[model samples]
Target chain A: MFEGYTLAELGSIFAMQGFAGLILFSVFVLMALGLAIIFGQMGVINMAHGEFMILGAYITYFTSNFFLNYLPALFSVYFFVAMILAFVGAGALGMLVEWGMIRHLYRRPLDTLLATWGLSLMLQQFYRSVFGAREVGVELPQWLIGSLPVTDVIEVPINGLFVMALTLLITVAVAVLMYRSRWGKQVRAVMQNRVMAGAVGIDTEKVDRYTFGIGCGIAGVAGSAFTMVGSTGPTSGQLYIVDTFLVVVFGGAQSLLGTIASAFVISQAQSTMEFFLSGSMAKVLTLLAVVGILMLRPQGLFVLKVRR
Target chain B: MRSGNIFLKRNEVVFVVILSALLLVVFPMALDSFRLNLVGKYLTYAFVALGLVLCWGNAGILSLGQGIFFGLGGYGMAMFLKLEASSPEHTAIQSTPGIPDFMDWNQITELPAFWLPFHSLTLTIVAILVVPAVFAWIIGVAMFKRRVGGVYFAIITQAIAAILTILIVGQQGYTGGINGITDLRTLKGWDIRTDFAKEVLYFVNVALLLGCLLLAQFVRRSKYGRILVAIRDKEDRVRFSGYDVSNFKIFIFCFASVLAAIGGAMFTLQVGFMSPSFVGIVPSIEMVIYCAVGGRLSLFGAVYGTLFVNYAKTIFSESFPELWLFAMGALFIGVVMAFPNGLAGLWQAYAQPWFDRIGQRGAPRPISPAPISPTAAPAERRT
Candidate 1:
């Protein structure tokens, strides 16, 4: 189909597709990081992880509305504040869930899956009742609303760039918190061996709560960022959950680095295929590829060296 | 003396058979059609729960894609019903010719080739069992052979169900998208709208439920059931002892899929419609909860769990629809925390003591501790 295209045209198309893949990768990483921590660290399958992201998106929506309606002059800078508020809102809900429901079901991982799933459905319906089932369009600041021109033929979406920057910052912050901070050390200890960590006087319960909160908070950030690229509806989270899980599982659930790499691979594959085929066909092909790969390497692309 | 013991066993079966007959024969007469239909739906759920008990409780595979199987069976029946309803011979005088209304809206000139076989009842029934079995077999071979178990397996199965639902919804022409297959009428020459047909369907569902329960019981008491439980508790040990663990997993997984398919078929028959909503990630998870809350280790748990959850769903939706999910969430949390064995576990824990004291003469044999913790044991097994 593109046999007659010039070299420069092909290069531009490739660059644009690459850029789209990077944007998608960032989103996937942001969403899956939280899930990986909850699932890999605590061994609790929080099926409501997507719902938590939706909670964040909803927070961003309301925050933007507040800025627009009550403080019109500050609208230009509302994105930063909205993102923070989203983090807190989603983080707080995560904490509440941990305290109220998840903490009790730690021993029964499978049961937690069902409980969180029910929680997701309930939250989705609640959002529908409160916000209406129609997709809500969040008003982005003028600075983040459009594309940035890279060349005569190639323009990169500012929102995509913004998401990439945000993902980078969050990734660095999480890396520092996990490796350099006391709480991170404690979380690692708990994840590695809870009994030993508890014996060593680490308050494992507190670490669990904070770890879960941070994971949820990151998911919220992802959701806030998603508003730029996708519609926000009561059930919008469902669209991302499968891909998010795919990224986490295929990347190897134990390592953040694996998540990033897997996200890059899957998103690039998907974006490239999407360029050549219909959207649904691209998704099916990507899923089939992931399933095929996972069948070969059940522990995913990376396996942490830990005793089973 | 062995013959006497056998007679006592047969007596227990006889009692159960008599009780089921009484319930099936009398319950519909006593209740309104709506309630009767509700009970019939519960029976269908019970069958699905039985499949869970086998796959999850016994085989130690936490399948989250049974909803897909259930959906396949449902759509299969729905296809036949839609065909039968839309046939020129049975079409209402006011109804449009050929295409169903949804198809007309979607501008479908002809039915898809895959849907052609659903015009026959026998084909539909065969497809219900075969479709899910084939799907499960392929997935099982890929996953179980690769040694994916525990959380990874659960997530993958869930992803399959989620993706399947999305695919179904996206295919607006054949699957009716999100709105699903609705406005279903007569079933195989029977007027579904009439109370007589509803009563007959109810009886059919009841018979199917009883038959399924018996089948599950038989499976559980067989040597194969013991091997399944052993596989759940210790896969490597069984493999080392010369058993092909993968084959066992595949067998049980296929069996569960068939059972789920049957349940799905019956459920659609009673409900008179099918939709993408009926089989999705959420419903799949709900099926697991039904098994969990009933106590996966117990046969009665499956039956009771489905009944209890479905009943709660009906009551809560009517009374406080908004709070229903929250309530269910709370219930799940509470059950996992306080009642690990589920409502059935609670019943057995408290009520079994009394029953044991009244019926047994000697002291109960000491229960041997299994090699792994019951809850954790299932996940440890590879195959």
Candidate 2:
């Protein structure tokens, strides 16, 4: 169809595709980070992680509504406040679940999968009951609702840029938290050797709670950010959970770098395929590729050095 | 001692005979049409649960993707039924010709190449079993051989289910998309709407369930079952003991896939429809929960678990629809935390005292504790 396209046109098409990929990669990273922490670090098969993100998206929706009605002048700043609130909201719920249910079943990872899965279904239904089943459009703030012109022939959406930046910022912050902070060290210690960490006076329970909260909080952030690009509904989280898990598993459970790399690879593949084919086919192809790759390297792209 | 042995033998023989009689004769008369249909569905789920017992419960491998196999079998059957319904003779009588409604809507002129073989019942049945087995065998060999275990294995399996669902849903022209293959017509000229057909399907499902359960029982008592259990408990230890752990896992996984396929086939037969929703990650997770709640260690537990939980779902959905999910969540949490042994475990525990009391002096006691197998830890943990 494009056989007669000039080199310049082809170059522009490639550039646009890369830009689209970068936006998708950011979303993928945001989605996977929370899951990696929950499943990879804590060994809790948190089927409710996606629901936590939806909670954030709903919080963002409410914040936008409040801003439009009561504080129209501060609409642009609503996202920041909403993001913080979402983090707290989802984090609090995560802590409650941890203390109430997940904490009791740590030894039984498989059981935890079912428990969390049931929790997810309940949450989804609860959202449906409260918000109605239809998708809710969160009005984008005026300042963030346009495109940024990269060239005469090519343009990128400002929201995509925001997501990319936010993803990078979050990734860097998470890296710092994991590597530089004492709490991060404790989390790693607990993950590596829980009994040894406890012997050294690390509060493994507290670590578990905090780690879970952080993971859920990130999910909330991802959800809130997703309001810019996707539909917000009762079951919206279901759409991303599989993709998020794919990234986490394909990346290698314990490696953040692997998550980032896999996100880039998967998103790029998905975006490029999407440009050529339809959306659903692209997803299928990407999944098939992931399954094919995982078949080759069952441990994933990056293997953790921790002894089982 | 002789009397005791005789009593034990009598109890085992009588138990089977009574159960068979109940299944063959009593159940049909005791239950109403709706209840019979519900039981039939449960029996189908029991088949899936039995497969899970082999893969997750017995093999120590938590396969979160049995739904894929189940869905493949389901879609396979649905495809055949759809083809049968769309035969040239039936199409001439109907308003639309050749293609199904969705295909007509989507402007598909010809049947997809892959779906052509489904017109033959023999080919369809073969495909139903072979497709899932082939898929599982390939995936299982890749994963088990590569030494993937624990959460990693679970996640990958789940990914497979998710990906498969998406693929099926995306191919709107061929696979009926997200709406799934629904509103199926008569199966092999049997009127699906008639009570007689439903009854026939119920009996067929019961037979399949009993046959599969017996086969599972045999497998469980076999040496391969012993090795599978060993691999589950300690793969490294088993490997050092000169056993091929991966091969055992693959074998059980393939077996489980076939069982899931049979369940799927029966499910499609009873329901007379199939959809992508039936084969996704959520349903796959539900399969695991079924085994967990029923008592993953016991074959009877798998059957019991499917019946009890699905019955609970029906009751809750009808009575307190809004709170159904909440109730399910609470039940799952409660079961995992308190009654980890599940309903089967509870039955065994409660039955033991009664069995002991009924036993006379010098009479052999039934319900002897079987030797603990390695893969039986999950079941034992529940107890």
Q: What C-alpha lDDT values do all the predictions have? A: 0.80, 0.83
Report the C-alpha lDDT of model 2 over B39-115, residue by residue, as the tens digit: 88777878889988877777778889999999988889988888777777766644457766667667787777898
Where model 2 places Cα greater than 4 Å from the true spot, the runs are: A1-7, A306-308, B1-22, B93-105, B360-383
True lDDT of residue B83, candidate 2? 79
How do the residues A197-275 of candidate 1 rate in per-residue lDDT, one tens digit apiece?
9999999999999889988998898889888777789888877887888898898888878888899899999887787
Alpha-carbon DockQ of candidate 1: 0.40
- Relative to the unseen true structure, what is the C-alpha lDDT of residue B377 in candidate 2, on a scale of 0 to 100? 47
* lDDT, model 1, position B106: 82
* TM-score against native, each model: 0.88, 0.92
Residue A85 of model 2 has an lDDT of 93
List where candidate 1 sits over 4 angstroms from the true fold: A1-21, A69-73, A125-135, A180-182, A198-202, A272-278, B1-22, B88-111, B182-188, B355-383
**Candidate that scores best on lDDT:** 2
lDDT of 1 by residue, B122-216 (tens): 88888987998998999899988877776788888877887788778877778888888877787777778677777888888777777777777
Clashes of 1: 0
**Ten-residue region with minimum lDDT total, candidate 1 chain B:** B370-379
